[model samples]
Target: MARQTSFIKLEGTIGDVTFYKGANGSFARQKGGVSRDKILNSPAFQRTRENLAEFARAAAAAQLLKGAFREITLRAKDLRTHNRLYAMAMSIIKSDLVSDRGMRQFNLGDMSLIEGFQFNINAGWNTTVYARYTIQNGASDITADFEDFVPAVKVSRPTGATHFRFFFSAAAINAEANTVESTYVASPEVEITSQVTSGFSFSIPKLVIPDTTQVYAMGIEYLQEVNGNLYDLNNKVHNSSKIFLVEQV
Candidate 1:
């Protein structure tokens, strides 16, 4: 009889929403600074978090278990490939937040208030990316329609072939247009994208609402197809994923 063996156990924080920490490092929660768990437990938050968590874990597992080689060598190229795959996974996670329908309930701070969202790709095949949105309104009155907004992302493959794609639901949309009109400063239509290597970013003009009236919630459906197959041994392929939300002003 053969014994079952697990190669790696997946566990870690996916997307966490916290309030803008002041100089003292304290903010509000339900209204302003909230704990990660609070945001995670919310029905809407849980849905997207769970889905994305499953997707990320599955993606990591697939890389380890689904490959054709059994006793695989961890060569430099292999590590590099894994790093690229991980980056794709992170991108998928971020995209999910933007397109998640449930996130619409929470008021995200003003985009202008947000200094910027930073993405860091490390050398050890580990990559971390996060966006900081300044929460002006203690809370948000608007909701997001995850389904309507589409994530316009572009990926460029460098070393070898990599597979990646994503989609959103109509549910993710701007709910509180009335609020944004009064609050924040509106910037000229800005476009963000990745370098030629393998990343891209672009804000949807129509989706950009007045930072005062409506909050911005974005969802992303992501897919990465390295070979002909989409998923891994778990019958999961890195395909369609989303992110939804409502931003505050």
Candidate 2:
């Protein structure tokens, strides 16, 4: 390989210049300041080095996410779902990454957190007309149990409700306000309900979640049949908050 910069044995600094013996058996003089060792070891450069390291790790993490979620069914092949999920996953695991002066704190270091985590109904979705479900982690799957309520179904049931369904993603789930937007993924099944439910439960089948394809957010959608037409709750008239999301992990 050709030489890059000439290797030099530099002497003492002179004004803004320093005399040096080049590795190619030549003499040289150039602007000089601090020693290479001193600059490299300086505290000012430590943060830069740390930043470089963290960037490398984040890049690797992104690649790992791609590999794990390769089988993830998205709206498109090169969609940003996996990237969004990767960001979410890193916010949990690599959140505690710090510099030389940062206080060390314990945080999730890898994708292990996706294996098990608390699921909760989003605050916005805790509206009056929603059925309640209890989460249970069993040996085989995560079961959401819904039973009969005192008001015959749920406390504040969506009027004319006819269907209930589920969808999941690594990012915050959103529904089309009025028209169906080809933005997100929906679960395959939409259970038929009788405007009022007797209560229903769903057992989400579990699998060995890979770091690349881990799911973190889930949304439950309710549909109402009005005028012989099924309408979504997020039709702008329903406050556009139709999808009730559960934190999957």
Best by TM-score: 2
Q: Give me the overall lDDT of model 2.
A: 0.42
TM-score of decoy 2? 0.41
Residues 1-20, candidate 2: write the lDDT tens digits.
Answer: 12235565445666865555
Model 2: CA > 4 A from native: 1-43, 59-90, 93-130, 149-163, 168-195, 209-217, 222-249
Best by lDDT: 2
lDDT of candidate 1 over 1-249, digit per residue (tens) = 112133532233234423343444434333346568876777757676765665654365325321311111111123244454444434433444454442321223222221111111221111211222222222323222112211223322222223322221111122233122222111122122342222223233223334332223222212334445443212122111112333432
Ten residues in sequence with the least summed lDDT for candidate 2: 173-182
State how far residue 24 of model 2 sits from its true place (Å).
55
Error of model 1, residue 139, in angstroms = 63
The true-versus-predicted C-alpha distance at residue 44 of model 2, in Å, is 3.8
